[model samples]
Target: MKKALRRYWQTDFWREFFDTFLNISDCQNQPNLSHWGRKISVLLKEDPSRLRETCRLLRIQDETILQAPSF
Candidate 1:
């Protein structure tokens, strides 16, 4: 049961991230897959610590969500 909950949490987390990235890229007018790919690469290159922080926050969020009573 816990594993399934975590899996669902992970899926939702990534989906939200994808939506946010797409929105921030502002490429709805002229979408370019390659450009988006390059942007992600640049983001990682600029500061990997941000990625670590994101992961840390995700862990905390997962714990909080899991502790809540299921409806």
Candidate 2:
């Protein structure tokens, strides 16, 4: 189960996440952003380095943007 989740996190997660964000952004949904932000905050608290590595693997250059959720 962990492996499957890890795989999803590394792959489909980013795609779906970005897609969802774009949709939410287009709709000007603040609540959805807050919900997603909480999830990201929890993930960051769980493993910062791993998150960083996953972002790096995904070629996510916006480190500050990624870290913003935990603030």
Candidate 3:
């Protein structure tokens, strides 16, 4: 979770979202499989292009997680 959060923070798009008052609580209320999908959907409602950028950023984040060493 920490690593994922870190990778999420590393993205410019996510940084903007964080700065724009988007909170983890928004995701906390969502279902597991739909958390990200829902969050992106909400963001898209606000700004459609941002959704695409956020998705790309998240994909990079996911890749980072896959490449990270396990303890």
For candidate 2, the clash count comes to 0
- lDDT of the structure predicted as candidate 3: 0.61
Tens-digit lDDT string for candidate 1 (1-71): 22222334346645755776567655455446687677656665677875666567778778888998999
lDDT tens digits, residue span 7-57, model 3: 343377566555555444675554353665676576577876656666777
RMSD of 3: 8.2
lDDT of each: 0.61, 0.61, 0.61
CA error at residue 33 for candidate 1, angstroms: 9.9
How far off is model 1, as Cα RMSD?
10.6
Worst 10 residues of 3 by lDDT: 1-10
Q: Pick by TM-score: which candidate is best?
A: 3
Residue 31 shift from truth in candidate 3, angstroms = 10
Per-prediction RMSD in angstroms? 10.6, 10.0, 8.2
Candidate 2 regions off by >4 Å?
A: 1-9, 24-31, 51-71
